[model samples]
Each structure stands twice: as C-alpha cells, then as structure tokens.
Target: MPSSTSRRTVIKTGAVFLALGVTSCTGVPAPSPSSPSTSTPSAGDGPSAAFTFGTASQPLGLDPALSSDVESYRITRQILEGLVGVDQTTGKPTPLLATEWTESDEGRSYTFKLRSGVIFHDGTPFNADAVCANFNRWFAFPAALRQQAPGSSFKGVFKAHSDEASLSIFKSCTAVSADTVRIDLTQRFTAFLQALTLPAFAMASPAALAAGTADVLNQVRGGQPLSAFATNPVGTGPFSLGTWDDASVTLVSNKDYWGERGQIATINFLTYDHPQTRLQALLDGKIDGFDAVTVGNFDQLVKRGMQIVQRDPFSVMYVGINQEVPVLQDVKVRQAIEMAIDKDTLIRKFFIDNTAQASQFVPPKISGFNNEAPSLGHDPAKAKTYLEESGYNGEELKFYYPLNATRPYLPTPEKVYAEISRQLTAVGLNIKPVPVDWSDGYLQKVQSPGDHALHLLGWNGAYADADNFVGPLFGEKNGEFGYQDPQVFSKINRARSMPQGQERDEQYHTINVQIAASVPAVPIAFPISALALSDRVANYPASPVLNEVFTKVQLKP
Candidate 1:
C-alpha cells in the first residue's frame, strides 16, 4: 500500500505506465472476414461483436453502493461513474466525470466541476443534482446494511451532512452549485481523495433511479417497494446490463458513453464455483480469463502455453492468537510461538519464491514499511526456554481452520492449516486441528472474536494507505482484537492530521515501530497472486489494487 504522498509522486513520475507499457496490443493478423473472430466490432461494423470472460465465482449485485467484494466491484466498475477515477496505468486517482476540483485550506470543503453532456444508460441526463441524489441514498443506509449489502464494505466510515434547510437535499452532504458539491467531514481525513476513487462514491442519475416508480436504491432499508431498479442498473459507464441468467451476466456497450468508445461492444461474465473447472475452461479456450489459480496446476498451465500475471496483493496471512485465552495472554508465550515456527522454510515448501516472509503486520509494499524493525527469527531453543519460563505444562490446544478451496487469491485454507498444525506438534505444544466450511466459519470468526485459541486469517488493504493497515486491525471497536493503545492511536492521528511532508513520515515511522514492538497480529508471509489469461485477450495489466477495467481489452482473430 502506498501513502498519499507516495501515490502522488508515483503518478507524477509516470513510472507506472512506463513499467507496464501503455501501448495497445495490436498488429496481430486479423482472421478472414467470414471467419469467427473473438474481438468485438466497432461502430463501422453493421453489428458490433461481443467478448466473454470467466471467473471462479459469481458477482453479488449490480448496485455500486451494495457491492463490497472484488467480483461485485469489478462489475460495478462497468456500470457506474465516480467524480475521480483511478488511472488504469497507475493506481492514482484522476479526474473523470468531474472536470476539475478545488479544496479549501482546512481541507474540509471540496468543490467539483462536473463534465458536460453525460447521459445514463437509460437516456437520463447526469448532472450535479444526480450526484447529490445518489450520495443521499448511500448515506441513508444504516450500519446493519454493511452485512446485508453486496459491497457495503465501508458503510460506517463516512457520516453525511445533517441540516437540509441550510444546505442540500442529498442526505448529510450538500450541493453548492449546479456542477459543484460541498462535502463536510466529521473529522479531517488524509485519504478522502483516494477513498473517492472507490465504487461507493459512484454517481447515479435521479431520473433513471426513479424511473420505475420504485425506491430501488433505498430498498435495503425495508421500504415498501415491490419493484426496484438496482436489478436493472442505469449508469453512465461503458456497459449496460443485458441478460442475467443467474449463473452468468451479459453486458452490452453503452453507445452514448462520454469518453473514447470501448474496444469491446459486449461482455459475457460466466461464474463457476470450482477453480479446476474455470482453469479447464480457460485452457480449452471456452473463456478468456480466470482467477484464483491453484498451486498444483499453476506450473501445468505455464507448460501448456498460458500467460501468468503476478502481483503483490494487499493481504496479510497470519496466525491470530486469542489474547483472552489464559495460555496465550502472556507476551513471552506469544513471542515463543512466533520464534518456534520457521517462516522461511514454510514459504519455500508451501509457496513459490515470489511469496515473501513477513516480519511485521504491514506488507513491505505498503508505504512507511519499516525494514529495520527487530524481527522474531526462528529459534526453537529460545522458544522452548520462553515456554518453560511461562510455566507451560503439556496442555492440548484446539485450532480452527476454514476448509474453503478458494479464498480470494489463496489456495486451500485447510491444507495450509494442516501444515501449521504439524509444525506446532513438532514442538512440545499439543495441537488439535478442526476444519469447517468457509462461509459459516468466516462469518462466525469475524463477528465473534477469540472463538478459537489460534486461527488462520487474512486481511486485504482497502486503499494504499498505512492508516488502512493499522487503524482497522488494532483500533478500539474494530476487528476481533480489542487491543487499544492511546500512544499508537495518537501517532496515527498525528500522521492523518499532518500535511504531506516530513512530519507525516516521522509520525508513520513512530506508529510502525510501536506496532512492531506490540505484536497484535503476527505477520507470516505476503503471498503473490497468479492470474491465468488466454492468448486471445490483450492489454491486461497486473496491479496490487486488484481493480478490473476490461474496456481496453481486444480479443484476437
């Protein structure tokens, strides 16, 4: 995860596009005019062509505000437009529908100038009023919606403006001008600009949202509406929903899109529950791309002529110790457990070379990463001594691990947990392994912390920020770990308050040091993502952000 300043610098440096090579992949020989071609047709062609792709799982919803998962956000990216959009070449936020923006000195008030002549998929005009109406619906949802909605990941993060008479009618946030809106925050946030790049901030046209005489956007709150427009989305994006077959979704290109017309005129997204089936489909040329490649078949795919794209995703795979448990409450015991395991050996055996051994909770890709922090290296003798000192006798401990086959970008969770259990038994600790299905197990563990003595878990960074790495894990009232440190919170708060400069850097450095000393979550390894793509697909870029923008993709002849 990169800091705001680092992200800005990266954007200014233009290294992202240079490293990836932004030139469109063309020049391939076109097939015969009468032959079947995978590429979509242009406007010149009497009937535009469509492209199809495959994924491991189905998307949860089409509504941008209701989406939180990767698949849902990927689909939302095609149907919604935000004020600022992420650059495909770089992860930095750039002006999109909004032509320009200005911020007050205090950074509390921001005004945006909307681009002219934008229309929704339903032929509705998109303007400042539309933006306000969309935000109003989003801000109206309660905290419970986070669990109910498909993409309500950051539901409680922002508080809308309250006084409607003094300001705008769009919930808590107010609109100042026809093309400008003023967003007043409850507190100063350094990552607000980056947050705006997320799908939750997408703009929706009021006319389109209210077209069917049903409150589709507000249906999650239990309103008396039998018909909702969310199922049939209306947006100013490149694609419009065509057919939803429960197992697959079809999208057609929006002819009236305001920007450069997309190369592909249509897209068919097919979802499969099993990774093996998806991989087989990709290899057989039945689909263009698939994710969550299994470790066993990764090498086989490469041998069979498949393109593998790798990236360091923002996830920390670690063993969470139940601090409330009497055996794990002691700091010495925790340190002993950390030292007992050989992380490097585990990485070498279970993961490829690309997977890095983690010494701290935050991955090295994140900004303000502390390379010099003291790490707990493998030393079984020291671990034994600490265990003896803590008066640990032979006692049995039950460890819970999910039996999920596909967990975002990881392999089978049960296999990883079994290896861990074997390693723990090698030491004096008596271990019992319990495997449960992912869906029920994941919800139970996250909702009720400390359900097990130790469990395997992962965390993905919401944005490229150190605050994202720290605030959610250790902050009071957040995560399963109820650990609170005023000094740590103060340091993070200082970093958030300071402008982009040396002071902010110094504050982050302090927070990192504090976190290293007080290990709330033990960092194990930063795994690398492996994506399988067919030769027909072109211009796919690898990114840590994990955003999906396939409009530029062109299929082969």
Candidate 2:
C-alpha cells in the first residue's frame, strides 16, 4: 500500500517500516476514492529540482499522533522534525531538535538542551517552550479526541491521557528556560527517548496549531476527516507543503532548513494503487524513484534495468484474532487455527524467497526476540482434532482483508488471504471473506471495535525496541485483539520500564513466549521489503528503521 526481489532478498543495509506507534502526519485533504493516481505539479511556486516518487497508496492522515500508515509518514518524514532521530549506523536514537539530553530521576525524567537558531516553517521559533508545548499537548489530549485518532501515539506509547492522569507515565513537561525543556514521567520508560524519535513526537509550529485549529477535524479527505492544520502542516524539516491535489502531494524544499538541504527542490509523491502503475511510471520517467517493489515486478524490473533496494526483514505479517468472537474465545480453537497455517508454504508462495517464519512479533534483530517462543506447527489433522474437541460447530468466522493495498508486511492481501483461507478450510473450520478497499477505512475498521473474527494485518517496527512491536499490539484491551490478560499486561508494562540489558531482554523474551502461548494473534514471517529507484538518484537514504529523510538523498551528476 509493498515486496522482496533479489535472490538474497535484502540489501546489506537494514531498514524498518516505521509508521509506528502509527506515525501518521497531519496534512492536506486525502484523495477522493475515484481520484486519479497522478496529480498536477504547481510549477510557479514549486521546487526547481523536482523529484517525483511512486507510492502504493494515498496517506490516510497527516497527523503522526493520530494515524499510523506508511504513506502518511513518507511525506511527514520530509516535512516534520522529531525531537530525536535514529542513527543509520548504530540503530540508536540521536539528537535532532534536541542537541543533547541528560537522563535523571531513575529514567523517569529527561532534560533536553534545545538546538539554537531553529525555526518551524511558519517562522515560529523552535525552542524549549515549543518542545514543552508539544509534550503537554500530547499529555493532555481529551478522551474523545484520543478516540478519534486511529493511531493514538501517546495513548499507545505512554499508555494513558489526561482523563486517566494517574495511570499515565507522562507526569509533566516544564520549560526550564528558553533553551532547556524538562519532561517528568510518573514511571520509568527506558525507551522514552527512542519513542520520542517517532514522527508523532515531532514539534509543530505553535502558532500554526492555533491558526489552523490543529486538533479540529473540520475537513474530510479521501474518506478520512482531518483539520485545516493537517492540510497545511507547519514543521521544521527539510521540506514544506507546497500543494496537495487528487493525483499527487507536492513538497517544496525548505529554504530556511538548518541542516543539509541536499539537491532536491521538490518531492512529489504520486500515488499508484497498483504495482504495475509504479513500474510503468518509472519506466516512462514519470518519477525519479518508487518504493514497495513487489515479487511479480522483480524479474520485469531487473530485466528493464531498474535498481531495486531491499530493506532487511523487520515487519511481521500476522493473522489477528479477536477474542470477542464466540468461537475464537476457546484457546484450543486459536491454537488449532495457528497449527492449520503452513508458514513454509505461505512464505514460499506469497513472500520473497528468504522470508523467515516468525514465532513472535519482535524481530530477531531486537533484544527480546525469543528463539524458543511456542508455536503450533502446521498439522491439519491435529488442528481438526483440536477444533472438534473444542465443540466444533458450523460457525462462519468473518475474516477481513484489505483490497487494493500493498504494504511491506502484506504485499498481496487477497492472495495471502486465499491461501490462508484454503488452509483453514482444510481443517473443517467455516470461513467468511470480508474484503475492504485500502483507501476506504480498511485499517480502521479492522483495528477498531468490530465483530471481525479474524483479519489480515501486521506491524512495521517504529523503533528498535520489542515494545514497539508487542507493546502497541497487546499493551491493553486493544479492539483488534480483545485479548484481556492482566498478567500479560502487567509483564509488558513492567518490561517497558526495564533498562536495556540482560534483565530487560530476559523480561521481553518471557513476554514474547507468554504471548505466543496465549495466542492473541499468529506471527507469520519477518518479511523482506524492497524499493525501486531511477538511475537519477546516486544514493538514497535507506534506513533500517525507515528513518530515511530527503535531506540525506544524493543526486547523480
């Protein structure tokens, strides 16, 4: 909405698909359902050295704090500046808006030294007060507004908002001075800084927030409601929003940007709902580069002399189980469902060659990946037996899968669902297909409260921590899973506060193992995703955590 191509299936470099904690950025209206995939470029006020990119889908929303889709982040990464950024080499959080920071109060507080001489796109000074304002804004979100954002970055990361103040980790944000900002947490969150690196924590212009009514969703674009500020986001990044239309989103280079400006004058993200359209666009020189290269397009692209860049495995495609379904409430039934799925067959047929079967959500590169995570291996006979023993009835389970969408984790939803449905049917379980268009609220419908017994979805790691994977998916009573286990919840909450060491790793390992046994969802594979590029680009900023920013991109002579 994304695939792997090469025999090795990955570039030596690694990158994660982070739109996580669902990092959606606020932006202009979304494209209409019937809108064309291409847009008109504004020549007069647009960038001189323009770069057009092909994308799989239109961004759901622009507010990183509210949405969690990849397309939204693709644009936001250029226009927004997070408090921190991820280092390409070490996979650790580095200074961005905050030049340096000190951890005190047993990891419960952080004092940041703001970078001087920085300003947002709206000419608002980027200072300590700005940082505190953003933090305070997140900490004090109203419950109704919190429910409005599908991604809910603060609710997912901090676990609470103003309504449940006592339960929240965010205690206060204080402007220690014009250049210093102090954030006090009610509890230790060892990954606080790492979490801050998310685009959702990016600082926006205070004046723009007020002028544009950032919190108000007064406009509807592409079926999703947003605000005026969302339409024209003002942040201190390498690019600023120039124009947004049905066919494309145009971003002009920020003339006042403080960092490396690179050579790009404009970036136009052209939406191509299908993989072939993207390939054709690049072939026709309609774009400089494109992402989400699929398996079907690999040989054709390679034969046509396209440069394919593969990102290392970081996302886990899974079949989400909603316990609210009467039949799914039985643990035996859930175990049977997992056992019926042949990971080997599924990956070999639908995924890139080397995609590894996953036992848990956390990737192997992360500290908490458990080699011994319990898995119900493929066995149709065994699965049938378990289902029969659990009082088998002809109950049709509604399985939801998105249409016209491609993602790093889920490259082809329909094909994947067909295979999975075939496997599940082999074990005598009644199956029902509920297909939803990607642009038509597919993600929200599945993730929100619903009667969907099962669904096709996955998480692309936002940060380098296990919490980024498990914490958001199983942190609490998520509408998607409806998995309520107090013990598991306590363990996950405790693990988030542990220092990054053996003890913390062990705790995460335990949590992964526990979740596997509980079977809230089935972790299928560590998918290898790739991007296709035009020869015009000498080098692209491919990051392991998807921290690619246009400022680092280099152009060919």
Estimate candidate 2's RMSD in Å: 7.3
Whole-model lDDT for model 1 versus the true structure? Answer: 0.62
lDDT top scorer: 2
Write model 2 residue lDDT over 249-276, tens digit each, in one string: 9899887776667678988899988888
Candidate 1 stretches with Cα past 4 Å from truth are 1-47, 60-66, 137-140, 147-151, 155-172, 204-234, 243-246, 321-329, 384-400, 404-409, 428-436, 439-453
Residue clash pairs of candidate 1 = 1-366, 66-151, 67-151, 68-150, 68-151, 160-172, 161-172, 161-173
Per-candidate count of clashing residue pairs (backbone under 3 Å) = 8, 23
State residue 261's C-alpha deviation in candidate 1, in Å: 3.8
- For candidate 1, the per-residue lDDT at 83 reads 80
**What TM-score does model 2 achieve against the real structure?**
0.92
